[model samples]
Target: MPLVAPTTIQKVSGESQVEVPDLLAVEEPLEIRLGFGPTSNRQQKSVSVTMRTPGNDEELAMGFLFTEGIIHQPADIVSCRHCVQDAQKEGNVLRVELHPDVIVDWSRLERNTFTSSSCGLCGKATIEAVRALTPGPLASEFAVDAAILHSLAERVREAQLAFAYTGGIHAAALFDANGKLVLVREDIGRHNALDKLIGAAFWQNWLPMGQFGVFLSGRIGMELVQKSWMAGVPLLAAVGAPSSLAVQMAQEAQMTLAGFVRNERFNLYSEPARVRLAQMV
Candidate 1:
């Protein structure tokens, strides 16, 4: 699917008026569904309707299922496909079939499903609600030099094919402990972008990402910290600042959080020990 759509608009400078064409990042709604049980008595249900940039939706839905605590492991999913008769609605809906033996948590699906591009998590009621979702402490002793950390933004930017075209998408990338780029995913929503990255790792059976670090294109939010923590990603760096709650959560999870990673400098908001300075022999 094309990531950019052209739209015509009028430009005004003082009293002067000019018509021009503008490129917009395509935004569309995706409905995620769940299917379970035997062939004879299967149950299909609606899960969520999220606004996304219209690509890598299977990974998006799977990522949503994992970060939201809906599915525990990849084995819980039997199959995933876009299920719509009309071509117009094909990419808008994705149905994930679960293993017959996997239990479906119906109550978890009763919340609001309309996710805007600005925020993906809808019902985080309180700080406790977020704290309750925290995963165990990360097991990796991964450390990177401050000099290397500041360069992550450029390395991630170099790999963003979609952002280079639209100039309006958020990106999440995974880097190895040595600062090598592993993979990247982009979306109009920050959370969705991270989800797509995580979902790809899950599809490839790369869970418990103890050997990986995350680099986000936007600010560090609590949910982003939470999601990466759940996946056991030990270090997260971003080009923007970290929220108070995000810093707190990262500290609690024993994960390193860095922000303002640009111009050869970065602010370590949590677990500063993970960012090492080069030692002289």
Candidate 2:
């Protein structure tokens, strides 16, 4: 939570001087470590590593595991602990231990290396590679009103404290069945904010958020859709537009996808039935 102070300087412009204040941004390195199988006896396997903001490290780690198809239920996570043994060597490396009998495909994980907060898949092959890893599409026919989708932008924006302060952070929020904001997180990177929110939900035993929806402050892309899909969230709303591939994936997954949510208006690219435009009037 450290920030550099803004500075003001004067420059000679002919016979005049000008001063301006510089904004200070906070950045920190967060390392995510996976411990699979049995937290009681402390038996675990290191899966993937990621660099992110220091806050919400545990949630980020748990959300990562769920999205990556490593574990299904929250009980599978034995414990997520921040390791300080090599504090000097590793800056804020979190070690997550999982329950026994947990199955992990190390071969698939090894194929991909470190993931950045911005882009979840750094060393993956192609879009098809991600598609292959995703679990089968969802089957439920969940629905929400278009008015709710449009209002999501304002609710999400109101909850973004970091963005309000620095005007330089992305937010990811979860809403309940009634379109009420339940949880929100902000970070310099969109994915990191999502991971932090997911990670926090995981620790709080809020996984399988089947009756809820996800809202993003940025554009809806494949990575965001994949993350929401893995979390068992059936609907995704964004303040911006979505990529073509994202729409395709949402259709395949049977998930409702909305973008360009602004001023009580939005575009439903897929699963229109899920959004009740008629209910608003």
Q: Number of the top candidate by lDDT?
A: 1
List clashing residue pairs in candidate 1: none
- Any runs in candidate 1 off by more than 4 Å, and if so which? 9-20, 86-88, 108-135, 279-281
Alpha carbon lDDT of residue 211, candidate 2?
Answer: 80
| Model 1 / residue 51 / CA error / Å | 0.5
The 10 consecutive residues of candidate 1 with the worst lDDT sum are 111-120
lDDT of 1 by residue, 222-267 (tens): 7788789767788999999987768767887889999999988888
Model 2 lDDT per residue over 1-281, tens place: 34223546575789987786655346666666766554456554556555454567677777777777676778887778788689574546778777777877766555433232333343233344555666567665567766678788887888876666567778899887688898998777778888777877776777666788889899987778778777777888888898766776688777889898898778888877778757435
Query: Which candidate comes out best when scored by TM-score?
Result: 1
Local distance difference test, each candidate: 0.82, 0.72
Q: Estimate each model's TM-score.
A: 0.87, 0.80
Point out where model 2 deviates above 4 Å. Answer: 1-25, 36-47, 89-91, 110-135, 279-281
